[model samples]
Target: MKKTILIVEDEDILREIVKDYLLNGGYEVLEAADGNEALSLFEEHEVHLVILDIMLPEVDGWSVCRRIRKSSNVPIIMLTARSDEDDTLLGFELGADDYVTKPYSPQILLARVKRLIESRYSTKHRKAAEDALASCGIDVHFPSRTVRLDGEMIRLTHTEFEILTYLMQNPGIIITREQLIMKVWGYEFTGDDRTVNSHIRNLRHKLGMKANLIVTVIRSGYKFEAKR
Candidate 1:
């Protein structure tokens, strides 16, 4: 089935441009002029991804994204004219999967949309397989996508689970950011290294100090170091 994308931009021209580009790319596209309308449409449709502009009439994209994260893990890519680092970090903190600056190439945006859709679906498949793996205390089970601490179950997002699984599967072997991005994100992430760091922070936040199962390998990468 073709993935559905919701484009939320108050500018009529940009909205139509994105819609047309996505439609040409073989995706089902939905458009909303503001955050309120976008949220309503989001609630009504089975959208696979969201392209949200930061500035909106009813509500801003950041708030919209926070609200959405409250309920779903659907991939969101924020659009903004401001290139402020703080804004970008804030977006990531709110669970946006990616970001694109304004005056952006439509083709680049379309490519990002395609990648997000593909990654989300691919991760779903990986999760199903990972859900069956065996994980001992503070251990990761790659094939089953399971995490266990002291023989208890732990919940992780698809991205976090994938990253941990990769690390554990290669136990004691350090993997670079590029490799981790390819494995967990399903694409060559050209963005800052902080993307990986931010996700790791999130994984740690969820796993707590028990997450020492994953060790930062200083300037090289991360590894799943089983405690002796």
Candidate 2:
């Protein structure tokens, strides 16, 4: 079956360009010229992924992403004209799976789409295994990227949840910060440890005092410890 991708972009030329590439790549393409239309299409279709533009006529991408996150965990790749780091971070916070700057190569964008789709499926399979092991108390659905604690839902950013899941899977063993950067972010050369710290702070805050479940390894890094 062809995977469906919804492109919520206002640029008619750019939208058609992307739609064509996706169609050639064997994906079903759905295009929306505004946020309202995007939402309508979303509600009416089983979209496998979304490529959302930050600027729109009615609601803008951030607002659109916020509304979408309220009901769905569908993979989103945000498109931005600016190269601002803060914008990318905000998109990540709003559950975007990836971000692409404007004037990007169509081939590169297509590659990114293929990569994210594969990752989504692979993560789904891994989560099934993790769910079996984490069956009762805390359920972490990797593909859908939702977490449930004691049957109550918790909101977490992509990196935060990814880091938490990695630690949980390797409980009792000391996993270094570098290892975490590579594992959680899928890349190690971003040249900022602050990203890791920021995610940890947010994760701990979300987990509350049970933050103790993640232990700092003094000089080495950190590890996950199940509370007794």
> TM-score for all predictions?
0.83, 0.79
Give candidate 2's root-mean-square deviation (CA, Å).
3.5
TM-score of 2: 0.79
Best by TM-score: 1
Clashing pairs in 1: 130-143, 130-144, 130-145, 131-144, 132-144, 133-144, 138-149
Q: lDDT tens digits, residues 1-228, model 1?
A: 888999999999989988999999999988999889999999999988999999998899999999988877778889999988778878877878787888889998988787767655654444555444433356565544456766776766556666777776787888988789877666556568776788788877777766787789888988877676
What is the overall TM-score of model 1 with all chains considered together? 0.83
Candidate 2: regions farther than 4 A off: 123-131, 141-146, 155-161, 174-209, 215-222
In model 1, how large is the Cα lDDT of residue 223? Answer: 83
- Compared with the true structure, the alpha-carbon lDDT of candidate 1 equals 0.79
Strongest candidate by lDDT: 1
> What are the lDDT scores of the predictions, listed in order?
0.79, 0.79
**58-132: candidate 2 lDDT, tens digit per residue:** 999999999998887677889989888788777766667667888888888888788666655464344345553
Which regions of candidate 1 deviate over 4 angstroms?
123-131, 137-158, 185-190
